[model samples]
Structure formats: C-alpha cells, structure tokens
Target chain A: MKACKLFRAGDRPVLVDEDAALTPLCSGDEREDRQFGKGLHKEIAALQEMLYAEHQRKVLLVLQGVDCAGKDGTVHQLFRKINPMGLRPVRFDVPTVAETARDFLWRVHLQVPRKGEIAVFNRSHYEDVLHPIVYDRIDGPEAGCRYAQIRDFERTLAESGTTIVKVFLHISKDEQRRRLQDRIDDPEKHWKFDPEDLKHREKWSEYHAAYEKAIAETDAAHAPWYIVPADSKPHRDIAVAALLAETMRGMSLAFPAGDPKLAKLRVK
Target chain B: MKACKLFRAGDRPVLVDEDAALTPLCSGDEREDRQFGKGLHKEIAALQEMLYAEHQRKVLLVLQGVDCAGKDGTVHQLFRKINPMGLRPVRFDVPTVAETARDFLWRVHLQVPRKGEIAVFNRSHYEDVLHPIVYDRIDGPEAGCRYAQIRDFERTLAESGTTIVKVFLHISKDEQRRRLQDRIDDPEKHWKFDPEDLKHREKWSEYHAAYEKAIAETDAAHAPWYIVPADSKPHRDIAVAALLAETMRGMSLAFPAGDPKLAKLRVK
Candidate 1:
C-alpha cells in the first residue's frame, strides 16, 4: 500500500487486469462515503496550503480512462472546493498541427506545473501511445520504445520535484453502456456526444490492452498508478481523493525557516 | 501596502536609491521580530503546499545583490525548514560556450521552474545586464535595448502564469569592506576569497547604477521588486520571508473538485 517504496514496473498481465475493479475506499453506503469525502476535501485543501507554502515541489494528477469512464467528471468533482487560481485543468484532445510537429512530450513538458502548483491532465501524453497502439499506427517494437520513453520522462519529472499521481478510472463495460445510452437519451448532452465515441467503443478491448501494456511498462515508485473502481461514480471520486490526500501527507511538507537565527531577532 | 494593486514600474531615481536600506518589516524589537519571523516561516511553508496543490501558477524568487551581499546565505536560511524535494536552487554563473551560442534567455528559460516548483536563482540573468554594463562590454543604447528585452521576457513569463518576486539585497559599502577584510583575515576561508571580488568592489558605484536602471525598467505589478535592508541581515531575511508568505497567500491556493454527482454516490 506504501506505493513510493513498492511500486515497480511490471509486465502487462501482472500489472493490469481487464475485468477487475478495486474499490479501496468504499464504505458501502453512499451518504457515509459522501460525508467522509467532504472531510477529506477539507483535509486535502489544508494539505494543498502546505504544499503552496513550501513552494518547492509540484504535484500532477494524470487521469486516463476510457470514454464516459468519468475522467472529466472526476476533475470537476475533486477540484470544486479548491481555489481555481492554483489548479490548471488541461484537457489534451487530439494533437494540434503545431503539437505534432515536435515530440509528443514537448507539449506535455510545456504544460507540466511549476513549483507550488498542481496540474490535472484529463487525457495526457499516454493518449499518443494508447491511440497509436490501438489503431496499429505503431508496431509493438515502436510502442515498446514509447513506453520506455514515457517511463524515463516520468522518472525525470519525479526526480525534479514533481509528485506524479496517475489514476486510471476503472469502469465496467455495463456502466459504459449505460452512460453512453444516457448521453444519447438526453438532448442537452448531445453537444458532448461525439460520434467517434461509438466507433472507438468498437475497439474497447484493443484500447484496454494498449492501456495495460503502457501502464505496466511505465509504473514506478516516483509516479504510481492507481486503478480506481469507477464502476460506481461515488466510489471513484472518494477513492481517488483519498489516495491523493494520503500521497500529499507522506511528503512531510513544512514551512521553510528563513534565518533560524532571525527566529528571535527584533528587526529595526 | 497592497503590492499587486500598487506596484507600478517607476523611473530609476524613484524606484531605487543606492544609499537607502529599507527595513520594511522591522518592528523595532529583535526578539519580537524573530518570534514573528519564526511564525512567518511556518506560514510560508503552509502556503507553499497550497500553491503546489493549486498548481496553476509558478513563483520565481530572483535574488540579486552585489558580491558579498548574502545571496547564497539568504537562500540557505530562507529554505532551511522547507521540504528540499519541492525546492530547486539553480545558481546561474558565467554562460558556457553552448549557452553563449544561443540567445541569452534560452539558457535562462531552461532553468525556469515548471508549475508547482519554486526556483531560487542565487544570482540570475540580471547579472548579464549588470556586469556587461558596468564593464562597458555594452554601451548605453545597447543596455537600454537589453532592458527592453528583459521587460518583454518578464512580462511573457508573468502573463503565462509565473509570479516573480525579485529581491535586491541592499547593503552598505562599509559592510562590504568589513566582509572582505574578514574573509582576508581568515586563512581558513581562503578558498572563497576570489581576487575578482576586489576588482568588482572597485566598480561598486557603476554596479549600483546598473542595478538601479535594470530594476526600474523591469519592475511591474505582476512581477514586483523588493529592496531588502541587507545591512541588517536578520531584518533582511524576516522581511523577505514575510513578503514571500504574503505574496503566496494572495494566490488563494486550494485542492480542486471534480464531478459533483459523484459526491453522493454509495459504493459497495
């Protein structure tokens, strides 16, 4: 459970399972869980203040999940109480003409939070690998290299004062079907409903496999991946928030003393 | 003093005075000031955590002063209690051949803190402007253009989510003489006694004029300059820490929320 010490890169089959949902923080009662989550939000907010006061490191939340698995929804729920000035929510859609001109990480590096900041990426550089591998635009060998590159990139970020928390929202296929059907049933949601979602749904299993491969290859202590049981929306938010709060607390953040000698000095 | 609202760029004469040492945070009691500094350090660290959690903006502490002005010591004392994991102390020295080949800011931009990281420059790009002008490597009109370029660079950084805190550690000429004499008297500290220090001391007035010009040209609402009274070291540290703590608090950092619907979910 202490991921900073135990997380290591593992093979795809060992690291990610297609049919598993781990609801670690679930209380089995929606109301109780909601109450606990509210408290956690307050605690998270306090921890965030310490992180800002310390202003020496960064935290990045990487949210990657299948469409309608609630990536965008998770971001909205987790950050509603937090001050908007400090949180930058970057939703990486398709690569733009300029973004594709360079390495995928060029744009990613540009978006990474500086010290005393937190950045949540709705979809991230992981998409490049996931899409290419799923669509067969990249071969297994090339995909393997990309994974290695990602691992190195992540480690570099971690080593350079970034606490990276990557969460993979795990939703059941049935949940996805319901979510997609609900989107179609409501006219107000039509704008968010892309026809491409249905086409991409056809290759869900392939995308899942691609995810497993990439996550397994890149998983490491510096940047740990969490597989949240997102089949239940309440469970997903609480679990992820709990994980973040715990990770932040472990950092041992404190206010810096400037001139401890000046600790008792009378300035004139 | 609401700095953000009132910090307008002024002319060199009004903004910077070579002979004045401003002890802005002084309360006239050393013990009381020290106690307050201790409390402020704790507050500053807490604010740092919030900044990191909010992770939307960056804070840059650009420390500039004459030689023997306690830049290194200031960085050490200010960050003594901070989590080293979140802080990056980047000392910018003479440019290397590769760095000189590129534009001046190319190397500087590379060292700028990413979102959520505090980058403390012991001496900074400001050195390029100061030394060159004093040494006459660049004439008045050229120096003026350099100042314009610096203004543009700082503005771009500010507009792009960087909160810059520039500190000019103001010390007396007599203090430099005493510090240099102490260094020479102690053979044990010979390694730190650079012959170049004496040469730079001879150009003290020119260096002060250069700093005054550069600061005046670059100070703005988004990136304000603090003139700290380094003649009184304790006052200097306490004032700077207080300023930084106040600046960070103004950022209003907090943890973010996502998907309000997930707030009341019952998980099993």
Candidate 2:
C-alpha cells in the first residue's frame, strides 16, 4: 500500500506539509527499517539495469535538503550497486563567474541526462528560489520569474523524454544541531563542517518557507517532488530507493537484441 | 630514482618504444607489476586528498587506444582506490545534435575538473584528430586546424593549473586481433566486439601513422603523451597507476587548518 501510494505521484504535483514533513519512517521499528533498506537496494539495482538496457528514457533525480540531511550518504549507499557507467551525479554549489554570467538554469541544464542515462542533482536549480529568495538575493518579481523559468525548463526536458524526480530530504532543526556538533567532534569528518552552515541554519524558518512554496508551485505532472524523512540514515535510504525503484519499474524498457549469428558464441 | 624518472617524459613528445622509455623502471615482470600497482595506488590516494583539500589544481587524464587495448581495464584499476568525490571521469562518444553544433572543444570544456579535482577523459578531444584522420573524415587544411586547436586548447588548460596526462595504449596488431576474437567468442563480451573495429583494424598502418603524427605534434612540456604497452593488462595497469601516482606526488599539498578553539568544543 505504501509502495502504491509512492507510485501514485507519477507525473503529478503533490504538496508536502512543512510541519509533519519530518516524520521519521522507522521511528519505532528498527527491524522494518533494515529489511526495507536491503530489499529496496536489490529492486533499485534491477530497475537501473532496465533503464540502462532500454537506453531510450532518461531519469533525473534531484536531492535537496538542509545541512546534515544525509543527502550524500543516502546517494552513496542506495546507488552503490548500480553500474557506475549509467549513473551521473552532479553536485551544484555557488555558481562560478562563468555560470552567473548566464541564466540560473544554464549550469543545471548542462548536467541533464541524455537518453538511457540516470542523473542525480545533489542540489538543483531550485536553489534559485530556495536560497536567493530566502537570502534576499533577489526581490519579489525577479524571484517569481526565476521560479516560472525553472518549472518551464523542467517541463521542456520532460517532453523530450526526461523523467524528473525531485526529493526533499527533510530534517528538523534539533537534528541539524546534533549532526553539526558530531562533525565538529569527529576528526575524519571535520572537513565536512563549515561555520557558514550555522549562518544558514540561523535562517532556518526562511528556508523552510521557501522550500514549501517551491514544492507547492513547481511540483507538476512532468516533474513531481517527494518529501523523504531524513532522521535515520537506513530509513532514508530505503524510502528514497524504494520510491525510485517503484517509479522506474513502471517504465517500458527493452534490451537491444544482438545479432543472431553472434549471440550463439560463448566466451570460454 | 624510479619515482623521479616516472614523471619525466624526456625531451621527446611521445615515448614511442615502451622498453626504451621505461628503462628507468623494470616493467613486464609479474612481481614488479604487482608491487608497482599497490605502491602507486597508495601514493595516488594521498595526492588525491591533497588536491581535493587544497582545491587549487585540476588534473585531466586522457586515454586513447585501439579496441581491446585495455583502456577500460586500466581506468578501473588505476582509479579503483581514488576518492570518487575528487574524481570525475567523462567518456565521450558520438556527437549529439547539441554537441556537433559547437566547436569540437565545447563539449569537453564543460567537463573540465574544478580546482582540486581530477577529471579523466576516457577518449577525449583527441578523438577529433584520431577518428577523423583515421577514417578520412577530414583532410588538408581542416585536419591541420583541428589538430592545432587541440594542442592550443590543452596548452591553455595546463597553463591554468590543469595537469594534463595523455596516455595512448599501444597494442600490436596481432594482440588486438587475439583480443577482439576472444570477445567475439564470449557471449557476455560479444556486445563489446564491434564489427566497425575490424574496419579500423584493416587500416592499422594508416591509423598508426596518424597517431604517430598527432602525438608528436600535440605533446608539449605542459601535456606529455605516454605510449603505454598494453599487450599485457597487468603491465598496462602498473605503468598507468605509477605515472598517475608519481605526478600527484610531485604536487605539494597541505591539509586545511581549522580553528583550534572551535575544534575543542564538545556539543552533546
């Protein structure tokens, strides 16, 4: 039933609730979390193979979240088993002089998947709405225009056979504080922590409101968004992977048929 | 002694003979290959960390070879230990409508590594010269201009702190025939055996001369070419891994220093 609900979002917009969005999937059930994670990985791997062999459709996965939302870990663990050849993950950061000179979507457009490819955007063009609007980088009319542009750009890509799946890894303020502190204490992970993260955290409510508005406005039939709980790493992996696998399993894919004469030869 | 000579490409543009070029270090011996691979992996990992932490220099690795010359195998083995976060491998194929419209370097410039990253071009801008020259796709002034553009483009990248390492995997005609036939005989590998490869094989002498000329013309102090003997997979892997590790070892890098007061804070 949960899996079915996940698939129902297909090519349809769904607004996520800000208050209840951080609901942990396995708050009271460790057993269920572990089982789901293991099963989802196998299913995702199979789905990935089908996508690769078909080589007709493209999948774009967008991961957006606050600091310590486990975006990187979720990607590394869930897609670890898939053949690296078919997977391309692009992480968006502060735009360079070259990127800023162009439209906000210019850098994002270059990373879009070609046919038979799966591309994951660690952070995406949505940042134009989420970050700039919240940080007051642009005023009302400008922000509104950029939002419409992103939605239209995504629509064009979908018409061209790109399947856009957006996921928001939602984490609570308390959890963010806990995770940031852990990074400070852990020597190996110290490199990941930055004081600037705290500056962003100070404007937590602003980011949350921006994200909520973006999800509600832009989540459309061509590109839908999924709000995944990010409190537990294993649960987050299972939920995200399960959603992707369920989405891909519904697609039509056929392997390329090799030459009949050549097919019979078995390498010894 | 071996480490110093490993990075030195001599005054020549390309090392035409494997035995003579690699005289500084013993190769082809199985024991030496194993030792070379292991040591090189460790050193390269360190270099990768420095490059990433310092976030200043960008490195590009270009691999070109005949089919079955072990390009795929070498990339897998050499980068097996490198941090995926710091490594970006771009494999170019037939041009798309978007790519074909621009200058030959347009698609490639998009994939260049950011500061403190390593980008590997499986078959790179060199394809403009290698493929076109081999197939008579272009000739006369057009071919000459393409070749000159490639050299100038690479020189500019190098001057901008992008370390360029070009490797041409060299396998004898007999060895290539043996490997291609092996792929044909194996069902799992049959997909890799392209009939078009045989077309290129028929013009081996022409390809060889074209490659020789391209290497000579393009190789410079900033971007040197390594003519790796790929008759043996293990030997090829060792040489490549060693060359990469030796290059990284030469770059001096220091870890990012964090504030001591902040580092001492414990938040529970």
Candidate 3:
C-alpha cells in the first residue's frame, strides 16, 4: 500500500528504469505479503461480484511482458478467488492467417469484456506495436500510427463504461534467462519452451526499447499503464493483485438495489 | 465403469429413450463412485500432459444437454486435475450478432483445440440444428442439410488428428424441474437460472426428438455420439470423465521420447 513508483498513473507514460528490478511493495516478510495477497484476491472476487451485479460497466486488464515475465503465472495466482464465468483470461499467441488479414485490433476488439464482465488479455495489442517495431516488420511511422490507434481505441473503451488497467510486467534479462532455463531443465514443461523464445532472448535490449516506446506513446489519463517489477515471482503476484484491487475500488462499484416489490413476493 | 450404455462408440448413433433416467454407471455406492471418480480425474490429467507432450493430436469434448443438464458443473469437476494451460473450456451461449454473421461453425471453428490441446464445448454447433428444428424455425429438409454440414465439419476435424467425443447429458424432466426450482429458491444462485429455460422446458420432448434425428443423421465412425444419463450430477461428472479417459487411451497418447541430447544438457 506504500507509494510505489511501479504503480505509475499519469497521462505521460514514464519510462521504466532498465534495472528497476526492486520490489517496492514487498513487506520484506514473504509470509506476510502472501497472506495479504491472499486476502486481496478474496476482496477482488467480492468486488467482481458487485460489478457483475451492477451490470452496466466493464473492466479490462491488459497484461504485457517479455517472455518469462510471469504474465501467465500472475494470472493463475491473482485470479484464484474470482469466478471463471466473470473472469475471462484470453492468451493471444501469434495471430492466425485470418487474423493477419485484418487490422491487428480486429481480433482483440472481438474479445473485449461485455457488460458486468472482467477480461484479462494475457498478451495484448501492445504486442502488435512491440513485435513489429522490434523485428522491423513495420517502420517507425507505422508503429506511431498504431500507437495512436491504440490510444484512441482505449480512449473509446474508457468513455463507454470500461475501466482499463494496463500493466507492464518488467523483468530483468537475467531473470528471463533463468526462467527460460528452468523450463528447458524440466521436461514436463517442455511443451511451454519455444525455440522462438531464444530468438527473442537474443534481442532483449531491442524489445526493452520497443516496450518503452509503446508505453510512452499510448499511455493516457483514461488508460494508465503500471510498470510492475517482476523479478521475484511472489512479489509480482501480490503487486499485480494490489493494482487490480486498487483499480476496482476506484470504480466505486456497488451491488445493485432490488425492487421493493420483489421483497414481498415469495417464489411458489 | 461396468458397461455403462453412455459410452456408445458405434458408428450408428442410437436414440436416447426419452424416459431413460437410469444411472447404469453408478455402482449403487455413492461414496465409492465419488472415490473412483476422484482417481480417474488424476489419470485424465496425466494423459492430458502426455497429449501435450506428444504435441501431435488434440481432443475436442462436445457436451450437449437441455437446460440445467450440468454441462458447466461437469466441466468444472471433470477437468479440475488437468492444467488449465491445456484445457480450453468454451461455453457457447446464444451466439451474438457477429457470430450470426458467419456460418454457425465459423465461431465454433475459431475455438477448436489446437495440437496438444483439449477443448470442451459446453453446448456446441449442435444447437444450431436443435433449436431451429424444435421451434419449427427450420423445416425438416433444411434441418437435414444442416446435419450433413455438421457431419462434414466434424469429419474434417477428426481427420486432422483431432479426437472428437460428443456426449449428450440426459436428464429427466422431473430432474430438470427440481434443478430449476433449486435455482429459483436460492437467491445466490438466481443468476444461473434463466426465465427462458421454463419456455424451453415445455418443449423438452421435441428437443429430445430433434437431438435423436440430428445424432443419427450425423453419426459416423469418425464422430460417435454418447448419451450419458445425467440425473445424478456426480455420476454425470464421472461418466464424462471416463468417456474422455477412454477416448484418449484409445488414441494411444504418449510423451515424446526424451532427446538423447537433453539428458546431457545442463542449465546454469
């Protein structure tokens, strides 16, 4: 709950320090922070129920990170208490042939949360800007155009009853190396280890620059981007949980009122 | 597991007698059945991991039943042991405007299991046939055409290394009435109950007939339809789990052989 620079909320998106691997929110006691996060998950679940009951607005949590930045793991832990019906976690991998034919946002727009729902994009439209820019698939001008499009798309969503929270899971190059190494060392997790990830690992600095540019260009008052330090898995989980809890509470969601006549009527 | 009629693997899909409410799989011992189901879940999970490790095939479990037939509950109980990374549970509610824009199978196709994945469709494209026919929204000839289309769609999927297992969760009218009443009685569960279900309840017999005609018309060696008595929720869960286990075992899924080079590779 302390002031954490990682919890950035402003119109001008700030660049995260490359070495910003420190967990500012850590209570310095692992068990204490774990317990606190456990309680926060329950609170978020309760708040989600109220949001669903309110049945008017929606929440969209966009999670972006480099490979092994714990976006998937954070989702698995942060959403344990939430109802799967209300919480839609969509992991967008490489776009299909059909998806490629359309604008990048076309597929993403299809998955946005409807009324009284929470949708978490595991890796989102941000990938379009980051990957194309990093791989030289698109030049600087095209990437800028996409950043503007994303800003407008998110601004429209925010204007039309959606609370948007974007998080950049900032993990160090060394940490990512260790995580990828862990996957390679465990044969059970071999399905998750992609050879393409090593190709991306070779361009970590370029990716870091891509992410920084994407965040700075698209960040807005309506769509605030938080850079969460994710070097420590436990810290990453709790920090993201806190960020979600804080975002939901800021919406001031409450359960809808019932019809007074319904109180008098009993079901047959 | 003693010769449950639910596991119909024959090329000709048989009609589920409208009055068939018997839970043949139940060993007449609820506790024992629960314990047995508990064990089967772990086996299914292990097989799923191997399926992922093999990364050469996919499994698609299509669950179809009338309102309050426990499709959602069965999915929750059945795949609990399986890693969610591999288990994709898609509940096909009434299609939206965008979905209706394309052929019925277009949206369904988008959600099919990829290689090394297990996708469960709560209520699949079969709804396209059943609902229209039951309400006379489509005539007999048109219904037949749609059935043929589904058969082709599924055959294509099965030919491409996808294991397709379709299970009809058969619950009695009395059982559905009780379940609906339970939802009505519990305020907390009222969200799960829909008013439209009562209208559908009146046409239950017609829907069953529609299902029989569609299944018989579409059943092929590549795609077999099973009718699982679902009056007992626990029994329904276990039976579906068993059906999935049987299907995967038949596929002879095994982990890919360990690379000789990986045995010597070390991670720092």
Candidate 4:
C-alpha cells in the first residue's frame, strides 16, 4: 500500500488503537525489510543533494511521538547516508525562562529551515498543544487559539518555499512498555530512560486525544501529517523514508542549469 | 610532526606565502594519505558521540579562508562519518540588514555551539574584521577595538565551557587561480562560482594583511589559531581531521554515568 494514502491523517480525527501499531506493514523478513529501508534512505540522500543544489527551496520534517515511539531512532536511521552539511536536526527540550516570556512560536520560528536546507525537529511546537492540554495548564479556548496559530505558522513556512511533512510515530502501549523495560534493564541504556516517562505513560489516553485534536485541526495540503505504525522499529524507518522520498519526488527538485555566458568567461 | 605543533599559529606574526602552501605535510602516496585521513575522521566521529553523550561542553570550529580555500570542502570531509544530530555546519554569508543593525558579534554569538554540539563556522565573525579592514571601511584604531571585543567574546565562550579551534586554510594565489578556473570550466560547478571572488583576488595582499593582524590580536591560549596549508586538498583534509581528533581527545568526553538507584527500578 502507498504509505501516503494509508498513513495520511485526512479530515477524520485519527484514532490510535493498540492493534493498528502492531500491523505488519513490511514483508515479514526483517533483514530484507531493512535493506528496502536503506534503499529509501539512499533515495532521500539523492533528493536532498538536489534540493541543496537547487538552492531555491527547503524541507522541514517534524517527528512527533510519545515517549519511546522511536522519534530519535527514526531520525538516526533516515540520516545514516545523508550529508550533515545540509541536514539540521533540532531537539526541543523544555523551554527556558526566555522562551516562555516570548510567544510560543518565537523559538520555533527562529529554527525554520533555510533555502537549500532540511531541518528535522525531534519534537516541536506541537508540544505546546499536547503537554499543556494533558496537564490542564491550558483549556479549550487557549487550545483553539494555538491550533489556529500553528496553522498560520505552518502556512507561512509553506507559502515561502518550505515543504512541510509532519509524522506521528504510532506505537502501542505494550510496545512502549517493552521499550521502557529494555532501557531500564540495560545498564548502558539507562541514560535514555527518564522517570518522568512513567508519569506521562499513566496519561497515555489523554495525550493521544490531544494528538488527535492537534493533527485534525492543523493538517493541511501544505502541511500534511503522516501517522506511521511504529511498533516495529524497521517498519517505522521504512514508512518515514517512503513518505519523505515521495514528498521530495513530488517537489521536482533538480540541480540548477548553468548560465550559457559563463562558458566563455575566463577565471584568470 | 605533531599536527598541533606543526600547524599552530604561535606568537610571531604568521605570514601566508606560496612556498608554505605547497609544503608537503603528509605521506607521499595520495591513496595512503587519504586512508590515514579517513581514520582521523572516524576518530572524530567516535569522539563526537561521546561528546554528545557527555552533554556538558561544546566545541566551535571556526574556518576562515580566502576564496577557493576549501573551507566547505574540509567541513564535508570532516563530517562524512559524523552524526548530523550533534553537528551544526553554519555558513555565514554577507549579513542581512537585521544582522548589520546589531553589534558585529550579535549574529555570531547566537550561532555558537550549544552544550554537546560541534558547530563548524564556514566563515565567521573574523569576516567582520577582515573584509571591513581590507576595504578601508574600518581604520586602524577601530580594527584594534574590534579585535579586543572579539578576544573578550571568545574568552567568555571559553570560560563557559566552549573549546574553540580557529583554522586558517592558507592557499597560494596560484592554487586559487587554478581552482577558480576549474569551477568556471565545469558546468556542474558553475553554481559555486561567484563573480565577486575575482574582486577579492585582486586585493589578496590587503586581505592577507588584515588576516595577519586579526590573528595576531585574537590569538589566545583558550582560542588558538591553526594555519593549515591548503594547496593540496588531501593534505588539508588530513591536517584538519588530525587537529580535530587531537583536540577532542584532550576534552575527556564520556557518556554520563546513570543513576545507581535507577538500576533497581523496574519499568511497568
């Protein structure tokens, strides 16, 4: 199935059920599936080079997922073959005092990808909608204002030459439990485990609802959201790669044609 | 020769000359030299992972060179095996109106590497001093004041856990002429060529004088300058990689030790 259609969160409010994340989207062979994923990654690298050479447009990939939904892993997998020169991966942690003092979009706006660049946000302004609502810090009207602001922000990015692709890595609660357990069990992986994750896990359903509302309200043709099944790490990588390759293919990216007069210009 | 000592710009005024740029600093075989360079690049990649995990200090690599001096090429080579998540390659162009309105270091200070990040500045605030002084826009006393300001700026970063490594890619005028000609001859590379490079070439002596003066004034124990000979691309890459690997080795970066109490905690 084409991931674009299968994973596209259209007008309907997208729901995350336990069984959906466990669905095997790839051919069952893990090794072959990883090879296929690598091919898609190579395609992304090629397209990104063209995007850099074209030097007229930009791409922003927003990876939003709950704790242990594989946002960081997906980014590492996607960029294994990509050049760091043009790829910017920004991880948004809790905002500082200065960030809170300004409008919510202030810091996010400062990091939009420049022309001929691709920027990936590990988590994004969507946090302002998700966390605050889950904690009862902001109510319905405040959320309505934020959703509208986000739509406007993304529209500005789109209107100005940036192609926006936002992905939600959908993982089942059971898978998250296994991942969290694995982190706690491995001494070396302890750094990845945060005690706060458990608190967030307790309110999974609330977070899911917030995600659904945010996606439904902010989704647009200019800035579409892809809901990728991410219970299986390999499947998550492949789906994101397929979605990005297809998005870039539609951009018609190419190297700029050289000026004809430059053929005769001497350097010395 | 230890690359640190060989390339170090010491107290005596460092001059750029054709003979110095042509000096052979590597093993004779080009293939063998590149293999060695790759090993150094890999070392940098490995050290960078630890640096990222350490998450306390930052590294800023400032690359200043004349037109066609391989600043961009060096960055690409150095990061071929490095993770993009922790690497930020910032290319500073002619400042926009907003940038010019502020203090010269305002935009630069904003782009300094954050904790755990390795930011490579393709061209840097040094341009603020070099270009202005070369064009007679800033007189001798003003240049001196700006130099002191830069030293103060760099000292603040150093004191606050930034390891600064400034490199000057010293290329001969003859080598630059050949590289510029090659760019003009290759249709695929025409996009990289700028007409204004020729205007800078005409005033190479003036630019060199400005560089010499700037380096002399800003050179500090914490923020030292390394003059890497760059007539041969492979030698230049090898020198830069070696310099970086050694610098990171001195940093004593390691993964943070996980909390001992967390070892007994079970994930549910």
Candidate maximizing DockQ: 4
Model 2 TM-score relative to the real fold? 0.78
True contacts kept of each: 0.00, 0.11, 0.02, 0.52
Q: Per-residue lDDT of A105-209 in model 3, one digit per residue for the tens? A: 999999998888888999999999898888999997898899989988998899999999899888887788788888777776666677788889888778988
TM-scores of all predicted structures: 0.52, 0.78, 0.82, 0.92
| Clashes by residue pair, model 3 | none
Tell me the deviation in Å of residue B140 in model 1: 1.1
After superposition, candidate 2 runs with Cα above 4 Å error: A1-50, A78-85, A96-103, A136-149, A183-193, A220-222, A252-254, A261-268, B1-49, B76-85, B96-103, B136-149, B178-193, B231-239, B260-268
Residues B1-268 of candidate 3: C-alpha lDDT, one tens digit per residue: 4333446735554445453467677788989998889888889988998987887899999999898899877876786566555667677888999999999999999999988888888899999999999888999788878888898899999999999889888888878888887776656656656677888988877887887787788767678788787888877888888888888878887767545455544433
Mind giving the per-residue lDDT tens digits that candidate 1 earns over B104-187?
A: 888899878767767787788898889999998999898888888888988998898888898888788877777766655554
The parts of candidate 1 lying over 4 Å away from their true place are A1-268, B1-10, B13-24, B258-268
TM-score ranking, best first:
4, 3, 2, 1
**Model 3: CAPRI class:** incorrect
Model 3 reaches an interface RMSD of 3.8
Give the docking tier of candidate 4: medium
- Return the DockQ of model 1: 0.03
Specify the poorest-scoring 10-residue window by lDDT in model 2 chain B: B15-24
Question: Which model scores highest in TM-score?
Answer: 4
Please say which candidate is ahead in DockQ: 1 or 2: 2
- Summed backbone clashes in each candidate are 65, 3, 0, 0
True lDDT of residue A200, candidate 2:
90
